[model samples]
Target: MDDLPRRPINKEREVDVNLQVASLLGTNGQWDVTKLIHLFPENEVTRILHMQVGNVHDRDVWAYSPHGSYTVKSGYTLATKLKEAEAVRDASEFVEVLELKRLIWKVPTIPKIHIERLNTRGLELDTCCRICKAAGESIEHALFNCTMAQEAWNQRSLTDLLTAYLKFMPDETIPFAQRKAIPWILWAIWKNINMLLYADTQESITIQIVHGMNEEEKKWVPPLPGYVKCNIHSNWRNAKLHSGVDYIIRDQSGNVLHHARDALTFSPNRVTSELSCLVWTLEIGFYFKDIIEAVKKPNDWPLFRALLQLISSLCARFRSVAFEVESSASNQIAREIAKSVLCDGHFQSYLAFGGPAWLHQRILREAAPISS
Candidate 1:
């Protein structure tokens, strides 16, 4: 009303009053900017307040359309010409051992070949298999063809399991939990090999090869609407072996927006990978849309300097965000998903989908009323 001139008042007023009028809106509607300028120029304010570099987030999406909707027609147009302006900086790779491919991440196993490879660079050291002492060591020889390694594995109840895994690739056919047994057993075999070589024959380790696994049951809670929530979990299987991370994103209504669970075989450590989870989550969010509001985060993880730096620089799109941790009881679902990826031996990502069905069932069961 204040923005309109005295003469155009009635037409503007008539347009405002056409709430019940039979008219196709937006088809030919002409937007007037004078009204916005008079209304404190929020666009300008947002521009001035967010003028800093790296915070613009996006320029293609309409911040506020006249109709206040992201029209399908516009979306299609954007999609057609959408060579979206993007930049990538983190060149580091997250590696998985079971799904080995050509990559830079080092496996914890120190086979003869690894030593030999290093020796080529002038770091002279023993390049022979510690067990057989028959020839120069190699990843293939140490883990697979070595007489001692094969003998150790052959002695175990898992010999058939190891043989089968070596012959076939790990996939969905393998049970979620069963898949982990292979990796852990291999670690055991490697560890025992070292012991056998160094220890005296009289004090040799008897054939008691044992492995221990722990199970946990926890519940996950939904976030409130109008905001987004990201759940992250991480694990380090062997101190000298590997690490991995998992994360999930949801709207305030608890509907999943995105989810990813993967093994980080190359990751430096559990804490680093856990913190990297936050950085990757924030990076993904910023990659698609601008961050506006943040919610509570648990305080469980140590506030490492690298983690803090990652958040400040990568998540600069927002004015504010909170970091906190939740109770372990409420984190069961996410934990399960992370463990699944580690066992499944792959990285999985999904968008606009529901949470894991088994987890949802457990949640619903707990919420159900007891028999009267």
Candidate 2:
């Protein structure tokens, strides 16, 4: 009751401090929206409604760590982040700093080039860019500002194009097709720099970038004989709007057995959206009970906890069903199907026996055997 936000206009109103959480729920076991709005602020009410209710009793859990259990590592990380954030005067500046750190970690390059990491090891080394010899070899210099790196990006015609587009627009606003080569280009630049420094080998950046892109273009593989592979993908736009879930089931021969597209009402976030999709996938698994029984078998928040239990129970019914993660390239069709509902403004849910009519050709192309 102390933590709950009260309605600003009804400051004088009294609330029952002894009110039970169950009392806040409607007969259908969902948050009572009318009651919540009457007692709390609109924003707080929305947060309450978004929470998933479960049959288990509520208990205290740490918020910082996954599985709701706290650890010294998570605690230290939180403290360090809080200390860093406290130094920043503006919230947006803190967010930008965090984003910069995330970008630095995402660069798939040699760790030794980071001056801070090298300094922490008590090693005194030259900080100049090994290739260009003009600027210090910080992450920014090594990845973007160095002469060699700039030449590679320029060679791919991505320097001005990406800088101009990304400055004014969000990453998602740019089509993935146009920006897919950027990562490979950066990887090639980093690889070239590392080779020049350590291996004394000079590889052509253009050739490396082309080779990496070609390797990543591998298509999806089919399941083994007598087994079915279910490729699932989820699209979560925001907490306020509905999210989409798409799952396609295919046999060993690469024939689409069944597929579904669902527009879920309560996504809230990506984790919840994907978890909901997993639960929905398991529910769909019930339909293939006969096929699964012949095969034989194996093997989160309160909402996540409940979903995990449901998944375990579902797995028990099957003779042998395993979950494997595939890259976005391999599951491109499923990803596209999931994105279609949100993109086309079709909020309805549907299940079909074969591949989607609109994507039939693309599906056939994806299912085709690769030529040697």
**Which portions of model 1 miss their true places by more than 4 Å?**
1-221, 290-304, 348-352, 363-372
**Could you tell me which 10 consecutive residues in candidate 2 have the lowest summed lDDT?**
291-300
Model 1 poorest ten-residue lDDT run: 291-300
Could you estimate the TM-score for every candidate?
A: 0.34, 0.62
> Per-residue alpha-carbon lDDT of model 2 for 1-372, expressed as tens digits?
122224333322786767777888889877888878777787777777776675655666666664455678777767766766566645665787777876976787664556556575454666777787865576778889998887777666677656775563457766664477777877888888778777778888778877887778867888887888889998898888888888998886678888999898876667677877877887877876731211122112433554555566777888987876677789998999899879988778888898888888877887677322
Residue-level lDDT for 20 in candidate 1: 18
lDDT, candidate 1, 78-170, per-residue tens: 553332211112322322431253243265655655766666645676766666786766666766678766765565445666667865345
Best model per lDDT: 2
